[model samples]
Target: MNLYVRSANGYRVASVDEVVSAAKRAINRKYRRGQAFTSPKVVEDYLRVKLSYEDNEKFVALWLDGRHRLIAYEELFQGTIDGTSVYPRVVVQKAIAHNAAAVIVAHPHPSGVAEPSAADENITRRLKQALELVDIRLLDHIVVGKQCVSLAARGLL
Candidate 1:
């Protein structure tokens, strides 16, 4: 399927990839380094743009500064349709490399539900402990799907 947008050109057509790419670029530009990372709405918008159409499981991390400003966003792991393995060691390594003071991690479910699994909670616990050793805060773990859920908001963190 394709999309058509009416502009000065009567009808301008765009592919899904083009639209998504444009959206991503717009998002990056709108949410620069100085933008606050404290809003759930903002985080959800960013995560949706990053993982909305993924079919396989993906793990991503957002490195933030002391004031929760964005430092880096990267995909750390990609897994099969059902699951991904996230290593705290690798997450800590990258956070240290980025000189991050805090982190927000997220993953999307191909199954279209944002509920955190037992495994998700377990990883969050392990990650929190690992990051604590280096003094980096684990701000939240967001599970994205048809809806986005924050483990922190649920008192899981």
Candidate 2:
């Protein structure tokens, strides 16, 4: 399927093909540079482009192993805007199911502000603690918008 993005800036058509292309470009750039992704926006951008063709509200989590490297990235949930929910227990369960050693969670702010809200902070703290109990590190909680913020880099996680 093809994806479309509409904003005050304008409308643009993005297909799954384009998304994969963009992600590959991003990954190659990072790999060539020998650096880890430093921002959540980068990851979000990859997912957004990759999933742009789909029609649903989705949240994705990127699971990492002990070395802070990507083990897997998957969509954790999907629903309409008014009533989507995320449970910490489910998150922990998924992490355990994946045998993830660490995690960097991310969700998009369609409104385009990367600021972490009080609720967002609280959730991150709760998830971090939960994961810690199982020896799975919460490496970061990233808020993606037109920009992105890393709670770990900001010392919030």
Candidate 3:
């Protein structure tokens, strides 16, 4: 059965089977269309269902190349209701390990506010700067909630 956590913003739906099915369906759709997806909302929707069982906040980063092709996606960290601990060194290392040319980062807000928090801004800035040293570019940092926000589009990164 699906479980849900009701918050002031909306319901946090949790069901591993449901999330996996959704993600597989999305992946299939993309494969069938022969297109690469760069939309943060689509990615976040897939991840939310995947991570619904975890009560804490979770962050996911998708590493891409210069051609805007996806290399890999990593769940950087998880934290309580307030925040998550992100290590710049680790993030940099992961980018290099994947040989990524660009990156798109995302995190879920349990409160359902897609706006980046002060800490989110700080972390994004730090990651961008760190990745730059390795010649990797940060394409976007997205905050996912009931909706989504893109830091790159907002000129925050």
Candidate maximizing TM-score: 1
Question: What CA RMSD would candidate 2 show?
Answer: 7.4
Rank order (by lDDT, best first): 1, 3, 2
Candidate 3, run of 10 with poorest lDDT: 28-37
Q: Which ten residues in a row have the lowest lDDT in candidate 1?
A: 1-10
Model 2 — which ten-residue stretch has the worst lDDT?
Answer: 28-37
Q: Candidate 2 clashing pairs? A: none
Error of 3 at 106 (Å): 0.6
Give lDDT tens digits, candidate 3, residues 89-127.
998998899888888888877787777888889998999
Question: Compared with the true structure, what per-residue lDDT tens digits does model 2 show for residues 29-127?
Answer: 554322344556555555455443434445567777665566677788775632246678989999999888877776666556668777678888998
Compute the lDDT of residue 137 as modeled in candidate 3: 91
Question: Which candidate comes out best when scored by lDDT?
Answer: 1
Whole-model lDDT, model 3: 0.75
Scored against the true structure, residue 117 in model 2 reaches a CA lDDT of 74
Reference-based lDDT, each prediction: 0.92, 0.69, 0.75
lDDT of 3 at 60: 76
Candidate 1, 1-157: lDDT as tens digits: 6677768969878878878888899998988776887788889999998888789999999999999999888899999999999999999999999999999999999899989999999999999999999999999999999889999999989
- Candidate 3: how large is its RMSD? 7.4
